[model samples]
Target: MDNSNMWIKHKNNRSIKEQVDILVKLTETHKKCIGLPKSKREVEFLKILYPASIRNLEIGDKFIGKTDYSAVGFGCVTSTSGVGYFFHKHKIDELKNNTKDKELLEKINLVEKYWCDKDTQENFRKELKKSNPEFFKKFAKNDNYSCVVCGFSRLSGMQLNYNKLLDLGVNGLKKSILSRNKDGKNDFYRASLEALDLFLDIANHFEIETRKLAQSLIGDKLEREEVLKVSNCLKEIKKGEKPKSFREAIQLTWLYGVVAGVVNYGRMDDYLGEYLLDDLNNDKLTEKEALDLVKSFWKMIAWRKTVMNGRVTIGGKGRRNEKAADKFAMIAMEATRINKDLEPQLTLRIYENQNKKLLEKGLEVISEGCTFPMIYNDEVNIPSVASAMNVSLKEAEDYVPFGCGEIILCGKSVGTPNVLINTLKALEVTLRNGYDRVNDVSLGYNTGKIEDFDTFDKLLEAYKTQLKIHIEELAKAQRLSYDVMKENCSFIYVSLLIDDCIEKGKELLSGGARHLGGTLEVYGNINSANSLTAIKKIVFEDEKINLKQLVHILDRNFNGFEEIRNELLNAPKYGNDEAEGDLMASKLHEYVCMCIKESAKDIGLDSFLAVVINNHSNTIWGRTTLASADGRKKGQFMANGNNPYNGTDINGPTAMLNSLTKLKTDIHAGSVQNMKFSRSMFKNHINIINQLLEVYFENGGSQLMITVVDPKELEKAYNNPTNYRNLIVRVGGFSARFVELDRQVQKEVMERTLYE
Candidate 1:
């Protein structure tokens, strides 16, 4: 029978198990057609599958029926018209039903059979090759040669070229082995093996596709030159010697990382050991060599070549020891310093123990205006990570920044793919009855007429009603975006480096990426800060000004009212540890989080909130907001995401965290709190680190980031640009040299109070 006829026949007469069996056979045929290897991780993942009998399934209900299960989680069954039903695991459920025995067994068998098929491995390789070619080429080259760092090289002595290494064969391979034997118990060894295998497969595919595309786009002349350069480098490395120059070493290391990513499931930590500080300090390698390696690796990946979103973490929590400004960090910092190009954006984390010198070095790079590496703080962040994962201080300290500064406990836990909500936007919609007063879009269906609001209480009530409507609409938009991302974008490079994907036979974007669920980051809640502050002064205290007058003042950019603008500024603001401003911020945060929860519940997905005001939100969301009562002018920037307007918080960072703690973190999604400290703050207040950690976990902080700089230095640098060229500050999630950031971002940073 024809292929179409056979597929139709298989679809109709077969049970789910039978259909899976046929599919498995087809997969093997496809694998042979593609010439791919069988992956053990995929085989093991398939063995855990079981069919669940779900009846009368609603849109958001838990997937419950009689089924044998090993993992602790709730599974939901979903079906599109053309696609068959699939079960997605959610929460943990212990109760088991008996009546659906046959259906449960069939489901389990199908899952197992589908995972075990060799075709799955082949399909994964095909997707990786299709998506990322640079990664693949680097991997193939590394596998064909010895260690790129300490291997034989043509540039070495005349006796140590490719011919010599080939002649030595097993001896050369033995000499290249870096790890000592540990009776198969070495975690690093096992991880390396897994990473190596994965890298080879993914990299091979990536290279093939990349070369093809380059040839097609740039023509064969340029493609051949590129290929020859890479080929020559590999030939030199095969002799068990190191590259003669720093640039070649950099290329080799970069290739190694790209390959390691494929094998280790896009995990940076798994490959960190292969290229850490200790390796350089021990005289085994040089800082220039390591830096070159990372630079070359990134250059080859050409992040901009593919349209996929990319994230890079340069500094992590525990990794920030006293000498945090060590050679390794410097290498990563410098690579970013010189290469300000946009691909592979970098994130840098700041901690109490961080080396002052290293911080300055990163600042030097940022002052060049590249907006990287993004800075995160460990003093406040460690406890925040602990709270989110329910772990200990030490365990949380081990957290690493992943997927755009989201904290993930390295090799232990996942906390990404969380839902995001814009709380500030919610308030705006609520206040305007679904009409964005700033944009004048009729987003809400006139839930409450503006004319009916006779009192402040009535206005607030109308705002709350409008907030609920916008929250519902925003959640729907998020789900649609998630669906589109999952279906259209395949994380082939990430799949190789990250864990669980290969084992589960799923791609990273397809619910296989480490962290599941949604996190909403509320923007402009601080706009409510201005609004509430205005209401208290105009409507309640003075009674000389009314809502209408206040609105007009704001609309006119507070023109001809310098006295009123000063009065509004003096009105209580959020993040000052004062009851009036703090309470309003807290109430707004809680109310918005609740709206997100209610709307997200309709889709059977767990929702959380994170207040990430990284960078000056000026570039993305801030460009659109109107002048807020917080003394901001119309078409001017609003407060950074979830952060108070610049220069608004009069109190110190401690007060800021205290005010932030007023919100109910347990009830909402997740939040990102960014605080900046001058280098002087650490001079006599080293103990402040402990205090910061204490209040963060005690007050239910989710994510905390800190930037360390000298306020005097920044001021001088700003005033005399040439004098302080090396000054740097953490802008949002990345660090840039103080002079490097855009004028507005620089102004925002300068406006932040520098504690003594």
Candidate 2:
């Protein structure tokens, strides 16, 4: 029985009256779906909303999906938005305040009354808080920084198995589900089938839109041809047939991923390689044409605007077709070179005895000020990931770095960096005996104060104890979140796409994923390490300043303590390739990684580790973090990711890169090493840049994200934004136009050493 025509007709450009009618219908549908299984109820919601939500195909849009895609998946906060369907209370109130349309406001109120406390976030929080109050209390009390940031929503930060979707197509997926569910009575299977039906129906809508747009633009040959191509690709996929061309493959991948609310597209070249090669060999489309389609795909990606989340991988070992994959990778690099967009965070994975031209092209793009094609060293990462995730090297080969730089085993793992731990704050709380002076609360466990720790080693151990207490609590919150979400939403969409979900006949969070692991995001690691190194050198070794005296000076944020601050600043810094400082950082890194990893079994997780994958949160969190013993002022940004504190790496780029490789990454999920090179120096010297990266990676560097900018150009743009509209810089894990970044983020970027 075909259920595609069961939903009502969609009116995207609806007036106030149409929206009200749709909301009323959804309210009625919600009442009808009350007793059904949770997965089936979710499908019931989408069955109505999918057709009624927005749909349009731009004149030159090569990809079918748009920025305003009414996409949904297993998410906590994303229970509903748009069309005024299931709009949470907060959104409803905001809409009423912002809109002048009285009819729209009435509809919003009606939806809010019907679904005020029924949203996923509200329900998930209510249940999980009962189990993990300490983690929830921080958020409830509005303390954004208590050395840890956690929530019950653990759905984001996962990589969907797009390769499985592309390989199976629509019909194959449905067939597999049916085979698993022989009786056809399973709610997960039923919900999955219904979701597929919605997927097809949505594709049909885009096809019709594309056809109409093609007809209207018949006079313009170029644009008409593009939409028509998209129309044909949509027609093929919606009919459940395998894609025979590259355009068909890309169209299916984008439309499905966008509609499924999946941001990360892992190992694109590995999965889409065969179709790309097949199309090129058969002359179905020119190389330029395929590249244009990818550009359109990038357009849709940038349109989503998932800041620091859209990760696309290419060029690594273990590819079934390395030749085709490499070819696709070169094209992807070219696309990054041409598009100059912030998204899809094009990543290139290089290994031993592989092509170096790809690296040169990536550098060339970076020199053009496109902070993209972030480099990953397979030689270092593969072995490191195998140890970190506790998987075989074969499984680790499927490693894909999702949001920021947290690594998950591509399609097989559920590794979301669910909590953000502030290592520096751990030290701060230990120094003050569990008091968070900045927030004026007892945030961490009451470890002994500075006076009790007569030796530096004792102080460091106390700090570690504080970190462990907070990590276990926050980690328990993460685990309980998964357990709670499993009872409410089946995560059916991802279950269909994620590996072993169908085989296990269970949802993603219900023991379906191969590796049901979690990650904790650790920030201020280098700053904390620097503080320890500085204290070890200036206070303990020299005995010039006692621990209590130093804590007092730090409490004042270095006020009237200029001489002691200078002494701390003059101490050995990590990024200078100094052994004493780097070794301290190494010790702290191993402790945090092993601590988190070892707690996985106790927390009921397969594997839980730390990811120093810093985002803009580093700047935001640093603003509230108190001053430290490392000579940093209070409320100032800490070091971004594993890089040294800004302006501290004076010995230059090579030394900094050398120091970055010192910390072992094998036991942790992932880390980011950001470097900024002066455009004037490296732009004309691509060969030297190539050799430099080669030596760095060969010397055990795991990953690097480089930004090549002209000397003083960031200052030029920051001062006069209108002058440099296209000045892009690497901001932690993502790149953004310098003029568009938040001012503090801009300041942090400006402060990094621009090696010239």
Clash count per candidate: 64, 0
- What is each predicted model's overall lDDT from 0 to 1? 0.45, 0.78
List model 1 lDDT by residue over 546-606, tens digit each.
Answer: 6667666766777898787777777888878888887777777777766665665685443
Q: Write down the lDDT that model 2 would get.
A: 0.78
List where candidate 2 sits over 4 angstroms from the true fold. Answer: 1-24, 67-90, 98-104, 139-143, 146-148
Clashing pairs in 2: none
Give the alpha carbon lDDT tens digit for every residue of 50-77 in model 2. 6565457766667766533221212322
Runs of candidate 1 exceeding 4 Å displacement: 1-270, 274-404, 407-429, 436-440, 454-458, 509-515, 560-563, 597-599, 606-608, 619-623, 660-729, 736-743
* Model 1 residue 493 CA deviation in Å: 3.5
lDDT (Cα) of model 1: 0.45
At residue 62, candidate 2 shows an lDDT of: 73
Alpha-carbon TM-score of each model against the true structure: 0.55, 0.94
